[model samples]
Target chain A: MSGGKLITGFAVTATSHTLGEYRARGGYQALERALLGMKPEEVTGEITASGLQGRGGAAFPVGRKWSVIRPDDGETHYLCANADEGEPGTFKDRWVLENAPHLLLEAMLIASYALGVRHSFVYIRGEFDLAYRRLAGAVEEAYGAGLFGKDIFGSGFSCDVFVVRGAGSYVCGEASALITSIEGKKGYPRNRPPRLTVRGLYQKPTVINNVETLANIPWIIAHGAQAYRTFGTTKSPGTRLVSVSGHVTRPGVYEVEHGYPVGRFIHEDCGGVLGGRALKAVIPGGISTKVLTASEIEPHRLGHFGDCEDRRVLPQSAGIPHLEPLVFEGESLQAAGSSLGSGGMIVIAEGTCMVRVLQVMLRFYHHESCGQCTPCREGMGWLHRIVDRIVSGRGRPEDVDRLYEISRANDGTTICGLGDAAGYATVGILDKFRCEFEYFIAHGRSRYDGCLECLGSS
Target chain B: MKHLIPECEALKARLPQGFESTLVLPCLRRVQEERGYVADGDIDALAQYLGVPRVQIEEVLSFYTQFRRQPIGRWHLQACHNVSCSLRGAGSLLDRLRERLGIEPGQTTPDGRFTLSTVECLGSCGTAPVLVVNEVYHESMTPEKLDALLEGLE
Candidate 1:
C-alpha cells in the first residue's frame, strides 16, 4: 500500500489515459530522450539498474534480455511485446492496453531503440480486438507526431511497431512460440539455448517483453532507477498489476508493490469472498501452478527473494492472493500438489465439489492441448476421461493410480509448459485431496455433503 | 458512405501483388468496418485489385468469424461465446438478442437494422458477458441492457 508510483505511475490521469491523451501528457517522452541523447547500452543500463523483470508469467529480467541482444552483430534484431495474455483469470494487460496504450507503445519504442531494432512486433492475441485497435491507433498517432517513425524526436534512432494478431493459442504466450507466430508459422514453442534473444523472429536477436513489463519502462526511465526501486523489495523493485479473480466479492485488477502481502491483496483489496464462504483452495499463479491451501497461505507472507540466500523464501513470481475463512491449507494443497501458476487465484468456495472443479479444469486443459506433444495431448485426454468417469460416479479405484501415472509421464516430456501444467493439476488434486477423491470413488458421492443434487445430475 | 467507399478503394490499391492472402482478409475487414458487411461486388473488386482468385479470397474471408459474407443490418451485434463469456451468461445474452432481433444466429433482422452473431472471444474477460456493437464494446451485458442497446440503435 505504501510505495513509490512505479507501475501505476500514469494510471490516474483522466484525459491522457487514451493514446491521444497520453501524447498530451508526455507519454512517449522517454522514447524521445532515449533516441535523442542516450546510447542503446545506456538505456539498457538504466533498465538493468531499475530491476525490471518480464511480466509475462516467466518474470525474467528485462535488462538481461537486452544485454543478450548484440546490436553491433547487426542482423535484423526483433523486439516482440508478448501481448498473448491467455492465462486464466489474468486480464491486467488487457486493462493496460484499454486504458494506457501509449505507455506500452512508448516502452516498446525505447526497448527497440536500446536493442537497435527497427522492425518490432507486438504479437497480441486475436481475441483482443480492442487492444489491437488501440495499439494500431497509437502507432499511427505516434507516427503522425514524429515520435515513432524515422528520426524520432529529432534523433537518428528509428523503430516501427507492427501489431500481429495471434490465432488464440495459449502456448504462443511463450517467447519462442510468439516469435514463431510473428514469422507466419503455427505458434509452437521452440527449445532454448538458441533462445529468442540470440535467434528469434527470422533467426535474429529478438528481445520479447510482456505488456505490463514494457509499460513499466517509461516510468523507470523518467523516474530513475532509485525512484523505481523505492517501491518493492530490492530484488523485485517496483509495483505489479495483480489480476485477482474467483469467489472474492470485488474481483478485479489491483496495482500493488511487488512484496505486498497476499492477505492484504485478498481481504483488503479484493473485498474477501462472497456470502462469507470459506476459502477452499487457491491456484496462486495461474491454474498452471500448484494450489496452496489456507495453512500454506497463512505462513507464507509474500515478499521478494533477491539473493541466493533468499531462495529459501517463497519465489516472488508466485502471485499472492489471500483466501479468507480458510478452508484448505498446508499438506492439503501440497497433497493436492499443484504449483501456484500465474497468480490466477481461483478461490473455490466451500460446498463446491472438489472432483467436479478439477474435472472442469481438466476438461479445459484437455480441450486446449495443441496436440503437438504426445504426452500432453494424449495424457490430458486420459486424465480428463478418468475424472469425467469419477465425477459421473463410475470411478474405479485403479483410476486414481492411472491418473498419477499419466501425469508423471506427462510432466517433462512435452515441448512447452503446457505439459507441466496438465501434469501438475492432475497430480496436485489427487495428492493433496486423496481422501476426498477416495470418498467419491467409494460412496459415488461428494464428501462435502452440500452438493448431493449437483452430484446426482452427473 | 461515398467518402468511406473511396477510402476503401485507396486501401485496396495499397495491397501488394502476389501476396493476396495477407491483403484479402485486411481488405474484407476494412469494407466490413465501413459498411457493416462486405458486399459480394466489394469482395470481387478486392479480389481483382489484389490479383488473387476470388474463391481463395472468399475462403479466407469465410474462415474468420469477423468477416461478414452477406449484407447485414445497419448495426452488427457480436456476442462473445468463449469460456469466460460462457461462464458469465453470454449464452443467455445471446438468447435474449436472438429473441429481440427476431432472427437466429448469423441472420439480419427483417428491417435490416441489426444482425446477430456469436463470436469466439472478445478478450474483455474481466468484464465478462460482453458484446460488440459495430466497433464499441458493451460489457457486463444483461437482457435489459441488450434491449436498451437495440432501442438506441433504432
Candidate 2:
C-alpha cells in the first residue's frame, strides 16, 4: 500500500496471464534490451548495482548469485525458479505465478540470457492448479510467438523454460531438495561443500531463484539500478510483495517498500484484525519465524538472518552491532526476536492460545522432515510429541525444558536449513510464550481457554 | 501381469525410449490421474512397462504423500490443520466433519462417498479454514458450508 505497484500491477486484470496482454504492457522489452544492446555481464552488473536480493526465505544477493556462474565454461548450466510456495502463511509467489505468468517468463528469459542457461525449469507446487495452467499456457504462447526457443529475438541466445510440478513436499522449497525432486527422487536436501552452484540438477552448474526474485529482473532492466534502489532501504532495497493473512479484515497481498512499518501494514493496509479485535501476535515472515507480540509489532525490523552469528539465537550478537539495525517497513522485527521471512505476515488476534500455535508449527515441521538427518527427523517428532502432550493437559512441567533442549540440539545439525527452521520455530514460541505452556501444565488448560485435546497427537 | 491401463501405452509412447528413472514421478502421477489411485497391480504394470525396479518405483510412490497407494472415495476431503486454519477453528471444523461423516481423519466412510483427512497447509491461509475436496479448494469453510459442500458433491 505504501509503495507503487511493481509486481502486482497486473494482478487484477482478467487476461493478465496471456502473452498478448503481457506484451501490450511492454513485457519482453527487458529481454530485448539485454540481448540486443548490453552484454550478459552488463546485465549481471546492473543487477548487482541494483542491490537486488533473493525474495525467497534466504535473502542472498541476486546479482552476486548470477555473477558466480561460469557461463562460457563449456559445461551445461541450468536455472530454476523456485515456485514451490509451500511455506505456511506465504502465498505471494502464487500470486505472481497465477496472475503474471509471462512476467516471470520474461524475467526468466533475461536471467537465462545473462546466466547462459539453455534449459530452465519453474518447479511449481502441484497444488497450485491455476498457476500451472496459466504458466503452461504462457510458455506455449511464448514458444509460438518466437519469444522463446532457437535464438530468441534474433539475439543468438536460446533458452527453453519448462514447468515441473512438485507433489506436495515442503522440503522441496529448499534448492537442493528441489533439484532432487526434479530428478524424480525424494525431496531430500544434499549436504553442502559441493554447493548447488557447482554441481546441481543432474550434476551440472545450476542457479535456483525464487519466483518473486526473478520477477524483479525485467523491472530492474527496464528502470535501471538507481531507480530500483529508490524504493527500498540501502542495505535491502526494492519493493516487496507481502501476503498478509490470518485475522486481518482485508487479507491479501500488498506491495510495500522496505521501510514500511509492520503496525501500519496490519492496521492501515490489512484493515486490522478481523471484527476489530485486539491483536495478540504476528508472525512477520512465515510460520517459520518466531511470533512477534503486539507491542513488538510497532517496530517492524527486517534483516537477512545470514548476517547474524547464529540465526537460531535472538537479540543478534555483537558480530555487527555497529551496523544500523536494518529496518523492514520502518521497524525492527528482528530486534523483537523475529524476522520478515518470505514476507508472510500472519496476524494472531486475542483469545488464541500460544501453546496451540507452537503445537501446530511443530506438527508441520514433523510431517515435512525428509528423514535424511537423524537430528531433524527424530528431534522434530520428539518435539511434536512433547508439545502434543502439553496441549492435551498431560504435560509435566519438565516437558517445557525438554522442548527447549530438543530445539537447541536440532539447530544446524542437518544438511539443509529445514532443521534450523524446525528448531527456531519451536524455540522462539517457547521463549516468547513460556507462560502459556506453564499455565497449561498447571491448570490443565490453555491460558486463553483453547481446546485441551491434543491436536498434534495424530 | 494384467494388461497395462490404456493410458500406459500413451505415456510409454511419449517417453524417449528405454526407462528414464526421472519419469517415474510423472508416470505415477499420470497413472493415478487416469485411475483414481495407484493400485499395487498398477505399480507392477508401470514397473514392467518402464523397466524400472519395482522397489525403486515403490520408493517414489511412498516418498510423496500425494500418490495415493490405496483407493480414495468420490469426495476426498483434506482440511488444513496448520496454524492459520487452526486459528480459524479448523479443529471444530474437523470435529464437525468427523461427526457428520462418521469417520476420523484418514478414514473413509463405509459407503465410499467421503474420505476425510488433514494436511499441514494448503497455502491458502488468507482464506483460513480452507478445505480441499478432490483437488478443488473451498475457502473459509464452516460447519454449515461444509455440510452444503458435501450435499452438493454427491
Candidate 3:
C-alpha cells in the first residue's frame, strides 16, 4: 500500500515482507538520494520539519537530537537505536524489524550522515532473536549494496552498523544503561547530567534514537520539510505506529497519521472489544501509565495526538493516551498524571478486575527491579507481598493506605523509571479502583464476574 | 612432552609478570566461537593467563547461562521459559523437543548432535514462544514447525 509519498523518492510502499521486497518497493531510495546530493544539515532540517521524535517512549525531537551532536568533537560518534522494547503491550518495533529491516537500516544510514557518525549499533533486546537476526541480515545486505562500510553511495561518508544483543534487563532501555551493556558492563542507569548526547558509550558524544525515530529518518529526508509537516497538529507532526493490544479484537500495530482520534482507532481500526464486551478501563501508554475507565474513553478527551497545523503532515508529538469523555485538544494526558508511553494501549474489558491487573503489573515491576536503589528494591518486594496477601483472601482495610504510602516513597527515589512504574500502578489503582479492591478484601473474592478466575490465571 | 613441559614452565613466567585478573569468559567465548566448546586444557591455560584461581573461573563459567562448562552438541537449542514466552507455550515446545530428542532440559543427545536448555527471557516477548538454535532465533513456533525444524537441523 502507498501509505504516503516521499519528496526525494517515490511512494512509501508497505512491501516490508523481506529485504529484497523492501528494495524493490523503493525503501532506501532516500538514502541514495541523500548520498548523491543532500547535505547533512539539509537532511536534519527535513527531519526537523517533519516533526519526528524518539519512538522509544520519550518523544524527543529527532532533529534537535541530531543538532546536539557537534562534529568538532572529532571523536567516534555512535548511533544506538533503542530496540529494547520492554514496554508491555508494545510490539511495533519488533514488527518493523522483522518485516521492514531495510527501512531501519536506511534511516540509520541517513541519521549517521547527519551526525557524521562512523559506527552505529542496533541495541536489540536479547530475547528478540528474530529482530536481531533480521537486523543483522539487513546490515549485511546494506554492506553488500555498498550502502555501508568504506564508502556509501560512492559518497566518502563511511558507516558500519552492528546489532548488539542486550541481556534481558528492562532498565537497559535507558540510553546510559544501554551504553553500559554495550561496554560489557552490568546494565545499570547512570544519573543524567552529562547526558547521553554529550558523553555516552565509551565516554564519547553519542546519540541514542529509538527504532521508530530512526525509521522515520528516511521518510523525512525523502519528503521535504514542508511535505512532511502536512499532517497532524501544529506542534506534533507525522504518522506513528501505535501498538494496541489486550481485550481488543484486532490487536496489532496500526500506522496512522498524527491527530487520529483514539475512539476512531479503537472502535474502527481495532474492531472494538471482543464479543462486544464493554470496555472497563484502558492503559493508554503501556502498562506504566495510569488506567482510565470506559467512561473516560467515551468522549475522547484524554487521547494523545501529534500537534500539527498542516493537514496530511505528521509530527513527532505522536503519543498514546486513553480516549476520555473530554476533548483532546491542547492539554496532555500526562498533565493528568499519566504519560502516553510507547504507544502500548492495553484495554481492560468489562468483568476484568482492576485490582488484579494492578497486582500483576506490580509483580512484574518487583521481578524486574534491578535492586540498584534501596527504595525500588525493598519497596517493590514489600508491595508484592502485601498485594499477594490481599489477593490470597487476606484482608486489612489499612493495606490500601499502606499501598499508597509505599508507592509514594518509591516514586522519586529509584535510579530509573521502574520505580515510577510500580508507584504509578499503586496510586492509579488505589485511587481509581479502591471500591473493587475493598470489595475483594471484604468478600475474599472479586466483585466483578470471573474476576477471581482472572486473578487465578493471571 | 618436552614442549608441553616448557609451556607449563612458561606459565610460571606468565603467572607473575603483568599479572591481571584474566577474563576467562572472553577467552572461552572466543574458543567457543571458533571450536564450539572449550577443550580440556583451554580452561586451565585461561585460568593461568588470567592469574585467578581455576575454580573461580570454573564457578563463573558455570554461573552464567552463556558459558557451557562441559562439551555441548553441535547445535545448542535454548528455549526461553520466562513469563512472556511461557505464556505462549514455550514450555510445551520444550516438552516437544524433549520427547523428540529423548532427553531433558540440560541433556545432550548421545551422538552429541544437539543439547536442550531452558533459558530466562530472550527479550522477544512480542513474538512469544521463541527458541534460539546456535544463536539464530526462531519465532512463533508451533509443534509442526518445531518438528520440521528439528528434522532439518538433524
User: Best by DockQ, which number?
Assistant: 2
Error of 3 at A335 (Å): 4.7
Worst 10 residues of 3 chain A by lDDT: A306-315
DockQ values for all predictions? 0.16, 0.46, 0.12
Off by over 4 Å in 3: A1-17, A300-332, A449-458, B1-154
Please write out the lDDT profile of model 1 over residues A312-370, one tens digit for every residue.
Answer: 34333332333332221222233333422344555545455667657766866776676
| TM-score (0 to 1) of chain B for each candidate | 0.75, 0.84, 0.76
**Tens-digit lDDT string for candidate 1 (B1-154):** 2334565454334222232344444455567667767787886777666566777666545443455656778788888664445445566788888777788877878888887776643455556668888768898777888888888897
TM-score of 2: 0.91
DockQ of 2: 0.46
Runs in model 2 deviating more than 4 A are A299-331, A451-458, B1-19, B48-52
Deviating ranges (above 4 Å) for candidate 1: A10-14, A300-343, A447-458, B1-125, B129-138, B141-154
Best by TM-score: 2
Backbone atom clashes (below 3 Å) for every candidate? 23, 14, 31
When 1 and 2 are scored with TM-score, the better candidate is: 2
The stretch of ten residues in a row with the least summed lDDT in candidate 2 chain A is A302-311
Q: Distance (Å) between predicted and true CA of A333, model 2? A: 3.5
Per residue, candidate 2 scores C-alpha lDDT tens digits across A146-255 of 88778888889987776677888999999999999877778888988698888898888899999999999999999999999888788778888888877778878888
lDDT of each: 0.68, 0.80, 0.68
